[model samples]
Target: MSLYRVFDIAGTGMSAQSVRLNTTASNVANADSVSSSVETTYRARHPVFAAELSKAAAHQESAGVRVVGIVESEKPLTPEYAPNHPMADDNGFIYKSNVNVIEEMTNMVSANRSYQTNVRVADMAKQMLNQTLRLGQS
Candidate 1:
């Protein structure tokens, strides 16, 4: 509604993107991990985001983005037949993390761009407020 609200909205946007980036980084970091058992294998994690509404009855205006939760992927892990691998299970098969590097990299780029956009929005709002104050002085 106001220029000040712009800063708040942008800040929330940045924070949400930060969380997304962190989760994406985590998923990427564990992408190469291997485990002998399905229970011990790492799964790709994704952040769940929800829109915060300002009013429930009146005009539906977004307050900001909120991270509701982080969920692990349900996709089955990669089962590789590594007979020589030390971590192989009884069946000579090892389970690799379900994280796809390309997908995670794409998510990282998107989050980075979103974060940068929020920063630019905040900066523009600050400049506008400063110019408005200068106008009143003259």
Candidate 2:
């Protein structure tokens, strides 16, 4: 693979991580939201990623990561007994969002780390290119 491909790969990685972080943030933000019905409760969302192959390279060579889609978590929503709450159902139960705050926090950290690593990779590639150019001047 060419050094230039590193830039493209790292860029795509950063982009994918950005989407992941956004979804994680959204999930966390709605973690405490309550609704009167299951249909009105917020569901945790997560970004789906897929590896794409580079057309310029061999079939097995990975081009970069792509976000296939965002999917809602299938976990059951938390039903709490809040008899005096405004959003309580007929049974005095309120459905809370399925978002797991701890899990979303973990995902946020992971996505942040991944994005930083990609940035470092791109920076190193730039430095290497600069040094190569300097070599011809000596």
Candidate 3:
């Protein structure tokens, strides 16, 4: 594969990480959301990713990352007995979001690192290309 493909691969990786960061932030921001019914309670959402692999072995193309979709966590929502709460249901229960703040924070850090790594890779690839071009000046 050409050095130019490195930039494309790194760009896709950065894009995937960005999507992950956004979803993680959304999950954290809605961590305290409360609802009277389970249907309305906010659940943690996660981004799905897939690798764009090559089918032909002769070319040996570079693979890139792609986001599949964002899906909500299947874990059960937290139900509390807060009869006095204004958002309590008729049966004196309130549903809380299933988002785990600690986990979300970890995910955020990981996504940030991945994004930074992709940036570094792109930078290195650019430098390599530039150096290759500079060889002609010698």
Candidate 4:
């Protein structure tokens, strides 16, 4: 692998974390939403990622991350009987979104730190390349 491949790997890491952040944000935004039916209720979404590894058979050894897909949680939604609520169904029940705020917040924190770590890695790679060029100058 080339020294420059570090940047590409770090970029993919950052991108995967960005997708995590976006999905977490979306889940948080819909956390308090109420729906008239279970079918229409919002569910938590999570991004799935896969790692791509270059094979030595092809004389490449760079590894990177990719988003496989985003999946909705299979957990059941909460239904409450609220006859007075405006959005209640004919049965006087409202379905609450299955997003857990605490869990989503934790995901946000983790993703933020991962993104920061990837930034530092890319920065370190750039510094190393610069130092090598400086050595040549000297």
Q: TM-score of every model?
A: 0.92, 0.92, 0.94, 0.94
Model 3's alpha-carbon lDDT is 0.94
For each candidate, the alpha-carbon lDDT, in order, equals 0.93, 0.93, 0.94, 0.93
Residue 72 accuracy (lDDT) in model 1: 97
Top lDDT hit = 3
For candidate 4, the lDDT comes to 0.93
In angstroms, the error of model 3 at 113 is 0.4
Candidate 3 to truth, TM:
0.94
Which model, 2 or 4, shows the larger TM-score?
4
Q: What is the lDDT of residue 132 in candidate 2?
A: 96
Q: What would the per-residue lDDT of candidate 2 be over residues 1-138, giving only the tens digit for each residue?
A: 777889989999999999999999999999999999999899999999987875436664549989999999999999999999998999999999999899999999999999999999999999999999999999
Q: For model 2, what is the error of residue 60's alpha carbon versus the real structure, in angstroms, after optimal superposition?
A: 12
How far does residue 120 in candidate 4 sit from its true spot (Å)? 0.4
Regions of model 2 farther than 4 Å from truth: 54-62
Best of the two (2, 4) by lDDT: 4
The TM-score measured for candidate 2 stands at 0.92
Judged by TM-score relative to the true structure, which candidate is superior, 1 or 3? 3
